[model samples]
Target: MTDAQLGLLVATPIIIVFAVALRRMGAVRTTGAVVAVAASVAIAAVLFFTQ
Candidate 1:
């Protein structure tokens, strides 16, 4: 995979973890979690198409 794809793949899990942690810590609400997951999926899709 290209560097961008690789980066996105790695970052996907980190973003998920961060979102979960934020929710657990009461820093992020449900909307924030949804946004975070959506953004990560979008990024992955972009990387997939571009690669």
Candidate 2:
């Protein structure tokens, strides 16, 4: 796999785990999770397209 794909594969799970941890710790709400996922996806998309 390409670097972008590898990055997405790795970062997506980390981001999701962070979001879940934040929610459980009351550091973030549902909206925060949504935003985090959206931002991660957007970044992944940029990496994918720019590569």
Candidate 3:
């Protein structure tokens, strides 16, 4: 994988965890958090392969 793709692989989970923590802290709504996480994964998957 390219550097950017590797970076994304590393970053995506960190970001997802961070966002989940935020949601648990009541800083984000459940619906929004779920959608964001799903979209993040989908986007990362698409970019990781297509690029």
Candidate 4:
């Protein structure tokens, strides 16, 4: 598989895990939650596209 595909495969579950853990850790605030997820996705995007 391509790097992008691999990134998606890896990042999806990672983001999900992070979201769930962060939520449980009391980071359930709207802004913080979004920012946390967004940052992870952004990092994933960068890795996905950078190759």
Cα lDDT computed for each candidate against the true fold: 0.88, 0.85, 0.91, 0.76
TM-score of 3: 0.89
Report lDDT (Cα) of residue 39, candidate 4. 81
User: Which regions of candidate 3 fall more than 4 Å away from where they truly are?
Assistant: none
Residues 1-51 of candidate 3: C-alpha lDDT, one tens digit per residue? 799899889989987998899899999999988988999999999999998
Better of 1 and 4 by lDDT: 1
lDDT of 2 by residue, 1-51 (tens): 787788887988899889989988999898988899888878888887777
What ranges in model 4 sit over 4 Å off? 2-8, 24-27
Please give, for residues 1-51, the per-residue lDDT of candidate 1 as tens digits.
788878888888898999989988999898999899888889788877888
Please state the error at residue 30 of candidate 2 in Å: 1.5
My TM-score estimates for the predictions, one after another, are: 0.80, 0.72, 0.89, 0.56
Q: Over 4 Å off in model 2, which ranges?
A: none
Return the top candidate by TM-score.
Answer: 3
How many clashing pairs in candidate 2?
A: 0
Cα lDDT of model 4 overall? 0.76
lDDT of 2 at 49: 74
